[model samples]
Target: MSRWILVGVLWLAGASAAFAIDQEIAFSDPSMNTRYLSLIREIRCPKCLNESIADSDAPVAADLRREVRRLMGDGKSDDDIKDFLSARYGDFVLYRPRVSETTWALWAGPFVFLVIGGIVFWRIVRSRLGQPLDDEESAA
Candidate 1:
């Protein structure tokens, strides 16, 4: 039993090495490195769904990080890189997708629901206000 436990402890210690990002990208300009970091945080990992590329350990996130660095080296503006990725991967790749006709519903849906809820609440309260208190409760 002690032998198996030692093996398990060794396995757990080595497992974290797999999660470390092994890339050695070097940016000549500090600003470019900053931009690269920002872009990775803003872009969603295609495989991870909810994780930003910067936070995801998925292979696709690493590939996307490489592509972002390549684009920066090619002198592409941040918006241009984003546009390229958006065109290739669809708007879902962007953390803050452009508000267009298709996305208007997504942007406006919350406010619309809030307004409907307010109306429903107001109607319920108004109706209750019009009723008298219960006779037993009023006497008490």
Candidate 2:
């Protein structure tokens, strides 16, 4: 019975330890915590599609969270931190890449495709509504 009690206490401690945030990021400033959270929400987890770094439990995401905190500690503005990470990684690291020449296709490709699809649909409908041309009509 004593051994079981000891095991229970150890289990509770271990469970709490697992949920604790990284010690290095115990910010005294509440604003810093808020800033970090906001920045993490905007950063994409490279290993997880459609998941922000804040929501991802992957190791890479954890490292990125720490790095963002470190950069915040260094007094980097949000844009500066984003630019730094974007430089190290790529635009894919950003949840929303900035609009620029390189990303013109990324920004406009979907709309262009939609327009093209609409034109094709219109042509198909028009063709289907027209009378079918028989060989006699063609000869005329």
Candidate 3:
């Protein structure tokens, strides 16, 4: 039992080591480093769905990190870097996409769906309860 446990622990350690991602950041200025960290935290990895480039281990995430760093080194503002990524990968690359015509559905879709659902639910409940929808209908 001890031998089996030892093997299991060693195997788990090796697996964890293999799955570890590089968390290094190279920036000359402290402010740039701060911005870089912020950018990474705010930018989603296109290939990783819900994971940010900072948290994802995918190759695409590494590539995005490199691109963001390079853009910063080129004196691009945070907005510029965000725009570059958003232009290339669309609003999904941005964790907080701006509200615009193209993204209106993304911003308002849930509420619209909720309102529609509420109306349907109200109608279903009213019908099941044999309640009249209007006073005129009840009188007739």
Off by over 4 Å in 2: 1-26, 105-140
Least well predicted 10-residue stretch by lDDT in candidate 2: 17-26
Which candidate achieves the best TM-score against the true structure?
Answer: 1
Clashing pairs in 1: none
Q: Using TM-score as the measure, what is the rank order of every candidate, best first?
A: 1, 3, 2
Tens-digit lDDT string for candidate 2 (12-88):
45434324444344355756765676688899988896888877888898888888888888999999999988898
Point out the worst 10-residue segment of candidate 3 by lDDT. Answer: 14-23
- The local lDDT score (0 to 100) that residue 96 gets in candidate 3 is 93
Residue range 1-140, candidate 1, lDDT tens digits: 99999976765443333234544433646456556666788999888999998779899888888888888889999899999899989999999888999999999999999999999999999999979999998999
Residue pairs whose backbone atoms clash in candidate 2: none
Clashing pairs in 3: none
- How do these models rank on lDDT, best leading? 3, 1, 2
C-alpha RMSD (angstroms) for model 2: 11.4
- How far does residue 73 in candidate 3 sit from its true spot (Å)? 0.2
TM-score-better candidate, 1 vs 2: 1
TM-score of 2: 0.58
Q: How much is 77 displaced in model 2, in angstroms?
A: 0.8
lDDT of 3 by residue, 1-140 (tens): 99999977865554343235443435646456656776788999999899999789899998898898889889999899999999999989999999999988999999999999999999988777875458888688
